[model samples]
Target: MTEAEKFTEYTIPRKDTVYCVEFCGTETSSQLLAVGSNSKVSIYLCKFREEEEVEEFEYEQLHDLQNGCRVTALSWSPETSITCLPRNIRLAAGGSDHRIQIFHSDLRGNDSVMVLEGHTDFVNSLTFDPETGDRLASVGDDKWCRIWDKDGNQELTFPLSAQGMSVCWHREEPVKVMVAQKNGVIKIFSLSGQMQLMSFDTNQVPLMEADWCVGNKGLLIGAVAGSDWVMFDVSVSSRPVERRQIHVEGTRYFRWAKCHDSLVASVGRPGRQIKVFNAKSSQTPITLSQTVTYGLSWHQKLPALATGGDQKVHIYMFDSL
Candidate 1:
């Protein structure tokens, strides 16, 4: 296993805890990052300066949105360019105010913004479609999953039996989405049919986070409440093909490396340990840090990782095995 070397660290200029962080572009065109903190979302522009054969992150603070509530979820639209339109960097965020807010970089510092209201409680997650970046999916504690168009119109809403925790779009199939619920069930829904296509039951504990394998088809990874990690192969069966006790306590965050097919990262309670596991093997993980990590995000284009906790964000560079 290859150890990840610490690249750089930036301390957020606030005393509040950071709930989430996300990159604003793909690996090929990433330009900004959005950080979700208490009652606001701050934007940072990723700048690079080459020094002694190393590229450093010189992120500049662009702006901050006062959401009037705790911002819990954030997602950026896919990078695209059309003939007649200017380049747009769209951001979607959900918060405790029970509304979803959409912002565009082109219209920053202006009154041109859209807010969609549907969830009755705190929204937990938000994800955009990979193909056209028009459709967005959001889930919340109110047991509702909603889909919205680029124009901020509600296209569809589904009522779930359990509270929703996270939602993710398939990398290859745009119409398919996976939603993790509090009752330990991950359901895959078809946007075209507005119906659930498949469901996987962890049956261990509540599922807080789930992500699809970007490099593999029909493979899913989830973080359970009992400090366990489970991998499911939908093409084979609904049951998990592999399960392992990841943490001594509970885990709430899980992210798959976009460029590495075998590497998966997870974080949990009790300490500041982040573990990177090989999806195909049951060997010991390559531990990253000993600091309490509340948030984890991987750069889409580079082998870099950003973790937020302890009032600071640490960046790391690693070589994928």
Candidate 2:
């Protein structure tokens, strides 16, 4: 289970260097979308069918840069009309312009559905509540974490010491959200404004990204300075949890796979590498050799993976033995 694996690789073939990526939900798996310095976003629909292990071909592009922002961070909405035909997926993206805008694929002009203005700095991360799509958590260089009611205008803000680089929401409880600080401190708080539950320090390593595993029982955190990853059992910590370092290569983004277990994915330097690990594994994790890797996301309904890095988006199949 530790052998390095390369599923599929393709240069997204973009006009500029890519910075971020996300997956839009489909009836079975999901679609891959990416953003770049060209100030444009590219959406590549995933084409998967029965007995398929990888993507067959790139489907039609949803929307080009003609309307969307540079798209620093993108998230797919889980809430949609069940009776609607060709279900329209909703998405939220934030970028260098410091704006959090929402859009629905069914809308004309790709108009901005909801424009959220609060962060004084660039919005770097966005995460939707898995339980209820009515709420979202965002982090930014403003050195704070903000939670906004997906259906209302009330946003709860929590200030931290360092610049906010990334954010994630707990799976079971929609109110708990995690914020990663550029200074290497990871803080967990409740959307109810209860209190900061746990905090972990990475010795100022400056974690550019982080995520909490489903059930909110475990957390996976990565840093830039130390080419390593850390796992924390938040429930075991009284005030602040001491992070357990899972030594690996330089990691850039941290994401918890949407699968049924504590599966996690990361893309980082030292080279264009993608690694997947089981939080419950007593042994170490297995790294996948990707020609270039940047973003990692899991499918909602299938054992499929969507990743980006080189020049294109790649789709892979994941199965546990």
Candidate 3:
């Protein structure tokens, strides 16, 4: 397998672990990188310049959220174009305090905003709809998947049999959402009917994360405990189309690349290895880093990747495989 070239790494000092990292905004608009750590979330604006030699990120601190609880999940609103008004560059973060804090910043970098309260347990995941950016889907240890409108009003709630770990919205269909649960079940819900459409069990292991492929409609990837991953095509069959045991220890996080359809990155705990795999092939993966990686976020517009773990974040740029 071809290895990715390391670009740069940032060592952010934190008292606790960085649980999540996300790229806020879009490539053409105001872009910021949000890092979620224990009890705090930090935002950094990555300035890019096009030199003859290369393009690099110059990080500048934008804002800090001292939530007094662990920041677990983060989501950025999609960029919109209304030339007369200022861009509503907003970020939503779920904390261990059982609250979802929404932070809004303008082009001038003002980040003071609002907070939404509803969940009773640790909020695990938060994602905004790509189409309208008006609706948000959030899941938590409370075993409830909630949908909120632009005003932060609870539009609907679906109760699950077990605690929810991650939630994501379909890129093309705004009304569809998939939630990964602690009981190894991935449930798909329709916002129009507020009802469950279907569910799949991935080895009956706790499914920690799930991501819908950006290029394929029915393709879904899930990371389970014991370092196992399963790819499911909901439109074709209930069974998994591909399954692989990447890590012998355990895997808590995995994400599909934003631009590449066949590229997927996974982090294995107790092993502290980051691997990039070509999903279309079962060959040996290219090991990006040996350091433990807790969270990963791919640049929305570029072919770059950022990973957070062990009090540091590493950025890498890979050649086309």
lDDT of each: 0.74, 0.63, 0.75
lDDT for 239 in candidate 1 is: 86
The candidates, ranked best first by lDDT, are 3, 1, 2
Candidate 2 TM-score to native:
0.80
Model 1 lDDT per residue over 290-309, tens place: 45566677777655666776
Q: What is the TM-score of each candidate against the true structure?
A: 0.88, 0.80, 0.88
Q: How many backbone clashes does candidate 1 have?
A: 4
Enumerate residue pairs that collide in model 3: 39-69, 39-70
Q: What are the root-mean-square deviations of the candidates from the true structure over C-alphas?
A: 3.1, 3.9, 2.9
Displacement of residue 114 (Cα, Å) in model 3 is 2.1
User: How well is each residue in 169-273 modelled by candidate 3, as lDDT tens digits?
Assistant: 867767789898988888899999989999887874767777887778646555555578788888777778888887777787788887778788888756677
Off by over 4 Å in 3: 1-17, 25-27, 47-56, 80-87, 107-110
> Which model is ahead, 2 or 3, in terms of TM-score?
3
Clashing pairs in 2: 11-311, 11-312, 12-311, 12-312, 13-311
Which order, best to worst by TM-score?
A: 3, 1, 2
Question: Where does the lowest 10-residue lDDT sum fall in candidate 1?
Answer: 1-10
